[model samples]
Target chain A: MTKYLAVVSSKAEITALEEFAEQKLAKDDAIVLLSHPYAYGEQARLPGSVLKTSFDYLNREELVEIEGERFRLVPNWYKFDKEFEKSILYKGIQLGELPFGEVDVFFRENLRFLRGLSNAIRKENPDVVLTGKNSVAGSSVRAVAEKQQVKIIRYFELGKQRTFPLFPNLTTRKVSESKKKLSRILSELGRAKRGSKKTVFIASRGYLGNLEQELREKTGFNVFPLELFLLRQSINPLVAVKPFLNKKKLQGLFADAFNKYKQSTGFRENMVFDGVFIGDLFEFKLQQFALLNFPEFVSLVDRIDALFQKKKPCLLVVWSDFVPFEKICVLTAKKYRVPSIAIQHGIFPAPIYKKAGFIRAFAPLTADKTAVWGRAFKKILVDNGVEPGRIVVTGSPKLDSIYNRHFEPEKFKQQLGIGNKKLVVCATQPASSTNNPYQMVEQVLNVVERFPECFLVVKPHPVERTEKYEQLVQRANCNALVLQKTDLHALLNAASAVIIHSSTVGFEAILLERPVIILVRNQKRSGHTGKPRLF
Target chain B: MSSCLASVLQGKKLNELKKEMRKFSLERNICGDGKATERVIKFIENTAKKTGKIELKTK
Candidate 1:
């Protein structure tokens, strides 16, 4: 009998695996569904199958030392060096750590998943490894399988009815900017209505929460959303659309950027980080990214330069400095000698390892000052080597709405048709951070099943898909609501007890004076709460 | 379900569970008197004035 090890990351992948098995599996074949144990518990409904989870194989932690600084292997933080940062310059100014922000953070969170996956591949030694293509899990699985010399089959979902061996390469397809054009027009309209000589450029209006209105009414300065503001001030629609119109010109521009990067950094010849040949990693990431996205960067640089030339804002504010576009804005503002502030949008954890080079999203302040939620968050930043003077405890402007607005829980519960049952709110973390999101939902559903008095409402992270939660709830035949777009404060207010796996919602739930249960895989991973308090 | 969660939902008083949860201090004052938005505005006003960008409106 051939043994098969199937790896799944998202809930959608579960369905893909089911399809793969239906077409590929024989009756005598043995299968083991390897997942994050808590990620998808009973949802792996293949009968008579052995199951393994990411938690089962998280034994070893790998580190790559570069120039006496130890960095984690998963995020590939060796690329986050000063030399690499200096290479991607626009008009001789560094383009603000472009290649290593959002994606790196996700990798950092999935360190456990990667490590566990590598370990599982070694031990399971399955005859064939099946995985989805074009996912983090898929990429890691491919790397691990190649190293272990295991036969790997990548399953690709084509149309509604067809499963294919591989998906068509659509990278060379023409770029669509229709949505962006509409947004730019809308932004122009908004700016025309509220344009002023004395304007303070804020990040996205979405990040401003209720403060956007308050800033306009209370403060004398006109609040302008940064991208819209910049687009209106600079970037002619014709100029912006020109690069997309000429395919060859766009490719030529990308080639120029790539050649410049290689010449300046010597990355093509000897891009070694502390003895490891890391050139391929850069070739795949930084060089490839700069090549593919040169036009957008060029446009951004032009727009920013024009914004500074035509109209310089008194101050710039962003939700996070580490994010690519916001980082560019912050860096350019600094170059123009304009002050910028990055507000702390999410709660941060204390340093997990005592190592010197644990790359955190908040480290090495890019903005002149960082507006934090509280002293605790500020302390975390300071501990991470940020200057104390640059840290301000402004509290959370987003949380202000929860405190100020009156929420009637009883009426809201009635509206949801959950009549008088003890409401249990489970706010899930993203798949990267949590042990198993599927398992977490399953655990909550099990509790709701046991206690007839309790009703569950699963609130998935903004990044996560709610269909998985709905699927699990349906499978378990439980009375639970998987709400992705409901008012979080109302849900918390209506909840009799709040369950979380290290989310900012836990802090919110605590503030609302609700009973909270923090589900941690172990004590070591409980950096968000300092210590887990399970009551 | 784990016993801790099972116990939380298993006939325990909601007030008592809340009391226990509060015992584990989150170390920092999360939100202070719900005036965070006002403080953010005040910070912006101060920063803008210090930088000589825009004039603040006095209430």
Candidate 2:
């Protein structure tokens, strides 16, 4: 039996891929290793038997020890130690044993943990190592695979495609140069070996339901849903905690408590306990941390270096939204003689801040092949400096579901207890310094009052002040429902019409075959009332 | 910054803007030309071929 090692960044992605892998390969023979940035203890375990790797109690200590031999500990160990101490000490209890403060100790500890992972892979001596796209653990696996002379495969979940227009002010010259540089780099990486049984992983949910089998039939590359990753984390004991403590002090305290608890419980080194903690924190904050980690940067550089050293060609396919990371990937691809193809995540239009002139003019020229959602966005790319030849129109996969949806309005209305009445879905926009939701509510109420038979569904933007909406709903004294969940397809399907002020939901409503009215009331210009512009 | 200001100042009429936007609407053409997935796959394949690798079987 061919030995294969699958390293995953998150348990969610792991669980998602496990089902697909099980269908393709025997469960017993294939080994799956899950690496989380923080340890989640028993909570990280999968349903089936699988090996796990994570940061241990003395992760910093282990990293420090291994730093000199392998891996440069950027920002130094002292900074990490200070951060660790600060993270733990300020979290809850004012006084606890001060954790080891030496930067070298921390670096050695982390290095040891990484080595342990590499050693495990070496022992298994797997022919192929697979990981999710763009994660710390994924990057580490790539590094280990390179060192061990093992093949590396990455999985990515593609999302909806939309065409965005370019603001006219930005020029095409700058955009073309950037795209050319990226293209040049990707071309240098070379290509996969011909006739080799290439292991392919997809992270798209769209492919999971209806497209999986179709994709499999079409591509012959393994088509796995992103749900596998979700499953791993869902079953993990660490995933249950609600970590969104509003107070920073409380959050720190919880981290300290977690560390102490892990130590007492005899938690192993390099387990992703931090992930569990961070997962419980705000989603935005977690994303911010992931962006700052620089794992993607290191991994791209390392891969390019290896490719160059071996005189082998490689091609990297990446989503464009990871632009900052794309820069690193592009530069590394260039250095290592690799070719990269940037698939569009959504429509790229003229930069919103195009009023900033030259800054906007130079931004879109970064990708080799700029795959857009439609001709409009394509033109925007061309106007922004992308070579028209390099731009491809690949409609968004997310819209596939939208296009095929067939909703019975009466059935949905009955389910939601909405009687025979005209339904108006009032999708809220994000509240800005100049945009007041309260005033908009007043205007909407005024309109609703005129039509008693009409029911209003006031779905406020997730980040907006909920209390304000509640207060407005009360003030309006009209029958209303506020949508909390992100998916509003069902409600949209059942609506008679939709009202919003500069929201993407309006576009979604239009897709649902509903009339959309934009209501703009800028606080800066209170007296002005005009038909709002639809983008 | 001044250049950005100048462009905004040179704004087109609403009707003209709508005319420009007509090309993006569904009436003009289905954005994907009705074979988006296939197009994407082909692009990937061509890219792979250029890099000297056989296209991975999509199915």
* Candidate that scores best on TM-score: 1
Q: List model 2 lDDT by residue over A1-535, tens digit each.
A: 5456666545455654566465666655566564543322113234344664533122334433443332222222112233343443321211122111222233333344456556666666776666655544454555455555665465534223122222211236434533554343234223323343332323332221233334445653433222332333223334312222222444344445444434432222222221212121222222322232222223323433443344333454445413333444444454444555565443222233232211121234444565556666666566555678887777654455566667677877776777887677777654221234545665676667656777777888754546656666776667776655434777876776677765656665655555556564432232224432223
**How many clashes in each candidate?**
7, 92
The chain B TM-scores of all candidates, as shown, are 0.55, 0.36
Error of 2 at A443 (Å): 4.8
For A48-82, candidate 1 gives per-residue lDDT tens digits of: 67767766765323321121222343233333344
Clashing pairs in 1: A38-A436, A38-A439, A39-A436, A39-A437, A39-A438, A39-A439, A373-A395
Give the poorly placed runs of model 2, Cα more than 4 Å off.
A1-196, A199-217, A224-352, A355-367, A429-446, A460-476, A484-490, A511-513, A522-534, B1-34, B48-59
**Every model: Cα RMSD to truth:** 6.6, 24.0
DockQ metric for all predictions: 0.33, 0.10
Task: State the local distance difference test value for candidate 2.
Answer: 0.45
**What TM-score number comes out for model 2?**
0.43
Candidate 1 similarity to native, TM-score: 0.77
What lDDT score is found at residue A436 in candidate 1?
71
